[model samples]
Target: MTSAHPAPSNTVNAPGTLAAANEEFWSNSAETIFNEPWVLDFQAKMRAFLEKNIDWLGIVNDRTSATEGAEKKMLDYACGDGFLTRVYHPFFTKCIGIDIAAGMVKKYNEAAIELGLASEKMYAVKGDFSASVLELPKAEDVASTDLSRDEFFNFDFVGVALALHHMEDPETAIVKMVERLKSGGVFLAIDLLNSEGVSESKDEEGNGGNHHHHHQGGHSHGHGHGHSHGTTATGRSGPAGHTISHDHPAFSIELVKDMFDRAGLTDVDIIYSDWKLELPFVTDPGAKLLVARGRKQ
Candidate 1:
């Protein structure tokens, strides 16, 4: 039952280790970026959309909630500081949050424990999404790394929020993600849209690159151009000469649709487009937030 796609040949500029990037972002200005009241509100709305409309818990029951004794299992891929993880705990019977950053995972675990969600029913783990496969624990099994497609035929759902856009090869990432799902399982994704035709390019330092904005449609709606400056959640400048623009990777949207098709998923639905206003301090003006849902065939 395990399915894998050929490894992607395209090499996007490595953004360094995920942990380093997050640590830099957090230590330097993460509080300013993530602690804003408006940012919190936006996150709450997104979580609500996934929980209420997506029927996330019900989907975990193999998309057959009417069955009386179906056990539910779910994974929150690239789950940041477990912001969404906290919101999802009450809905699903068994939930696991995985993140690439060890620091992020540690913080999430602390939060979960504080919230009394560190019990056996719920947990968080440090995992790499770019890796080929994830070794997850089965419901009844104690501790085993012998996880294969044969042992667990399906996952009720897999969710990636704001995390996919960071990957260099999101298409390959999507293919691998879908292969982990069972028939009728759901994949929910929320990511930034590249409305401004921006591309990633490295500067002289060879540090992680930054996005340069290119005007596409007449959709300009945020701050003016040229080394855009804005306050962070903790009221700090993000990066030198970094503007808040909505320039996502070129293939972001198209790649999602193509992966859905290639994975043999159906009933592909755009649950929420333009869910909330993109943080003005992040990227280009009028940046869009897209939420899509697809069911594996």
Candidate 2:
């Protein structure tokens, strides 16, 4: 890992690609596109990425042993379908997930139960992670695990994936995620990089723009605001060969590194991974996703 701070010499304002309409669009899509076979395949790809890079067992065992078997906690900010939550459930003693979309939260809970995860192990709540603590849900009411909001902040690991671009203030979101981690805790984020500010949203067949489905599919360039069910593509194929499209805002590596530095994190590093999604008719060999990771001081 590199120890030096990133060169913030040529800072540029990240375009608010779908910041305004992302919430509404994603909320409507929660019920529709998230359940598509192709969308599910994309989510699997994301899970695979986490499984490859995240040492869940190592982190959990190390922390739990240090605390004399005290339960370790994990926070999934903007958790969406709780894809990462389910993966980390067995490793952490307590897992908490928060999302802006109620439908997505509902599905997260249902999926957790379907996976046979006990309620005490996983809890999904509908709320904006970017909101002030005063505006957050009652931590006690959010789950059976007895943890207060302040107590909830002391997490051993925090993961924010593919959801930062939709926020009105990505930097604030990063800062807040860092604030929630315990000392020496890890914070990891993976999302597209907007190096050239490319915001085009058209597939080969000229379907609707902004092809931002959850997990994996094709490259979408829009701010997804947590729309739930029905608005996303449901057909086998649209006017073209594939179905569904939504825009996703890409974050530049310089901007990502800057966010980590400002959040007071140490040992920050940027990694480029060959990320892609394979569907029945379409194989999206996606652009290099920027993974910004660090430890809280």
Candidate 3:
């Protein structure tokens, strides 16, 4: 099968990094990922797609402003600058962002506050979102990190966007995020449409849903602003897009649908749109937005 993000050679990148270094990669690259022009352009397109499909998404769309809501909540898992949560910010009473990268968490809150959103209105926390892996699904599986806190459970929705291909295990990641929802809460996710169709797009994603929210192009530090790496293997020296390479090559509708079904979610529906990504350093195929959602039941 053809790889979704296979880049033509003759490029500059850190070649020896492993998937374990993703946190450091994301931490170091957080500084500029938020404001980079190309990154902003990509996010704008994501916003447009979400807006265009608001009805299909089944989330709030009142544009009520972040300060007004105080009853419901949203979990922005792998939240990078809180894109999905930001779009639904006005409608939800409280929104919490969870990420593996501390810097990404900081950025999510900073951007919200800059837009006049108080910390209580919308906040982000740094946690190992890839938890619940080794241990069986138990009451205490999520107890180690802030993930176990009461404020973390029972959500109106939990949304992940554009970062699934960066996860080490997208399937397990789904199980973890789904456990955080209330009995009837919905799980929303977005990923690339995989230009090669189901068979070619069958490859999994990288670390987990990811901090690659800074990624639309390739991996280095992130978004051309130095936000995607850790420091060599733990830090990036110059303007790079990510600190590491993506282990999970790409995503397809079949793979995601299977994940949702395995997670025991009902009414799963996966859809795609005409939007595409044409960033400077990105050579991966499939630029269209692929959206998927299912209820916890």
Candidate 4:
């Protein structure tokens, strides 16, 4: 427990859509973005929503109480410092997280260690689903950077939280994430709801990259736009004018359904979260989380 563990430097991206700038932005913003109080409150709301929708999320019972040796596994995409990891912690025997920033990966590992949890039980690897599958890291790189290994495949549950809006292509990202699920596994998306479709798929000036925001200290998950709270988004103190102005509208229900269907998933259903969400992650006003779920049959 006393051993000093360094963040793994081996980074892997699916190959195509992840922008290098955004990746670097997130890496730089990782330190303090997820640390705000409002951000934590927002997270609590999101957690409550997940717990409320436990059955729909495919878990046997809420992990908050009633301990069991559940062997289920989960893949949390854009897992800034392991929010979903904590959310699913009680239900899983193992959980692997993927993020575009190495700094974010370090934060996830640090949090696990702080909780006295073993790395094998809960840990995050630096990678993004938007990369190219063809260029998966070489075999030797699996231990450090490669995400295409046997362990990285076949998750019981897969989720991409608020960060979906940051991807270069949501459709392709969904497909790539679904490929990680085993048969009958569930693929989930928990993001901001914008029935009003995005004017364009461009993510200009919001947190920076991941879940940006104003002055949120909760997980301080600064997508560079940072946490769902805060003046600096997440918590990155970037350049003076480096703020994101929520120009990118959140995902619409129809858009999410179409993505699930196109990815060859079955039994797809979408629901709005009971939490009246807001922030930059930064979040938005009157924001509702659209929780869309599908099973890979």
Candidate 5:
């Protein structure tokens, strides 16, 4: 029962200053985390996780570019470091990643360039995809006809992975993401859940910022576990290794269903991975993770 994401003693910061504050934290540490060796492993885990959990290739590969015929487009919202974006790049003809953290987006673009993704096919932009607060293409711009024509809303597929737990309002975020999709577009989400099945308590995350997702890795805001679930916890574990805990109440599977239903997504389905994941970076035993998918009507 090792603890996951033990913030390196020298650099743990405060809990999210606010729902939006997590972006600031990630902006400051974006480069450092992008350079971390564990990030590479994390990327691999992301790819494997998606492969094991969904028919990701089939989903992204389903669409074809109107112009190129064989190409498809995707958006990776809240795409920290574009780790997941890079993973899915090979499948889409064009993949655009957006992040609240400008530095993270910059690093994402740099990584894409380094991979020689042909600028037009893969790129990252700095923006808050969670809302339409920012205006694009000023009044004088030729392409600025209707705000509806904004590039932000154009995507064949959208993905939000390991990020919903950090949101100020996961439900609104889900609704807005689905709104960005064209009719029949797909939305995929993967996030951590509060498996304790216990009602949330103020003290659940504990103090001194020992909560999950407020990781020691300098990312500062996430849902990775930092505590123990004990013998009362029902899940089985693999070889003894480090475990991850949650700082905020884990979103229950039911909550996820409700959000999807409220968003009017059809064909919604969710599943919990049967086995526990052991990461090279975090030590604690892990929790059951949920994978969900739906299509916009």
Candidate 6:
């Protein structure tokens, strides 16, 4: 098992600081707050969506055959626990899973090894995704790295799954990811959508209210005071609060589309939309997961 302590190789100061301070929250609490059982179910749903919605295999085959005589590379940006990495391993000649959290990288590596994916063809690396500093030896150097002309530039596809929302500025992050792709490369983003806001109302007597109203016909449930709203133990807001050390932002469909468009991408397509059943304590049935794809111009 990997130690919970911060790795010496971590280099992104801000995110690394957040990760150091909140490591326990991310590694341990996530399994509880996010609810592993629910995550398994969501993974099943996502797998089904991939199989029925996108022609992933066909696309891979086409891309692979097209590049038969050359090297092909794909990246699973912010790959957590190697879930999607394992799923999409067959497509690319090389699949590199990069993440800032050492814990995630450790687990991803372990999973790859256990799953017999430890070959040079597929692997995970501990690095800062925002700054793209995989070789830096310390977390503080992430910002100083010059990403404007990095050497690992050639890639056929970059998959960002549930990662954009974790960044402070998703628009900028998406644009940077798009910039890293080769011309005509594919960029896929799979994320969650907040199903608007729904609040509970009290009765005239100030007692537990029974006035049932539906928002878009979705089921309604009573809200409890113990439900911590918009605040984590660290006093920060958003999903970061649930974790021990990092703050991850969430994104919506329109917001993502606008960002992609601004990045000069084309052939944008929303390939999947399915309810991401919330972990037992994090959210309700209102949150929906969305998968969007676009080609680099």
lDDT of candidate 6? 0.52
**Per-candidate TM-score against the hidden true structure:** 0.62, 0.66, 0.71, 0.71, 0.67, 0.66
Tell me the TM-score of model 6: 0.66
| Stretches of model 6 off by over 4 angstroms after superposition | 1-35, 56-58, 62-69, 131-151, 196-249, 275-278, 282-284
Tell me the lDDT of model 1 at 287: 43
Q: Rank the candidates by TM-score, best first.
A: 3, 4, 5, 6, 2, 1
Q: For each candidate, what is the lDDT?
A: 0.48, 0.55, 0.60, 0.60, 0.56, 0.52
lDDT of candidate 1 over 135-224, digit per residue (tens): 364556332223343422356677777665445445556776677776777777766444421222112114322222221222222223
**Taking the tens digit of each residue's C-alpha lDDT, what string does model 5 give over 1-297?**
001122121122243333345556667777675555655555566567566644632473453343456656788887776666666666667887777667677777787887788778787766553332434535564422232446657567888876665554567778878888878888877765554422222234354221222101111122332322332122333221111122322456456666776777777766554444554433335455556777787
Q: What is the C-alpha RMSD of each candidate to the true structure, in Å?
A: 12.2, 12.0, 11.0, 11.2, 11.1, 10.9
lDDT of 4 by residue, 182-243 (tens): 88888878765553422111232243321211111122222322122212112222231121
lDDT of 6 by residue, 161-268 (tens): 765544545566677777778888888787644332112211111433122211111122322212222422112234443322132233434455566776777777
lDDT of 1 at 138: 55
Error of 6 at 47 (Å): 1.6
Q: Can you write out model 2's per-residue Cα lDDT over 1-297, one digit (the tens) per residue? A: 000011111123244323324445455566766667766766776667656655522364544553476767888876767777766666677788876666566667776788787877777765564422324345564532322467568888888876764555666678888888999988888765443311222222144322321121122334342322221211223322111112324465445656676677777765544344254432233444556677887
Lowest summed-lDDT stretch of 10 residues in model 5?
1-10
Index of the highest-TM-score prediction: 3
Displacement of residue 33 (Cα, Å) in model 3 is 1.7
Which regions in candidate 1 have their CA more than 4 angstroms from the true location? 1-34, 55-69, 131-153, 196-252, 274-278, 282-285
Instruction: Give me the runs in candidate 5 sitting further than 4 Å from their true place.
Output: 1-19, 53-71, 131-149, 196-249, 279-286
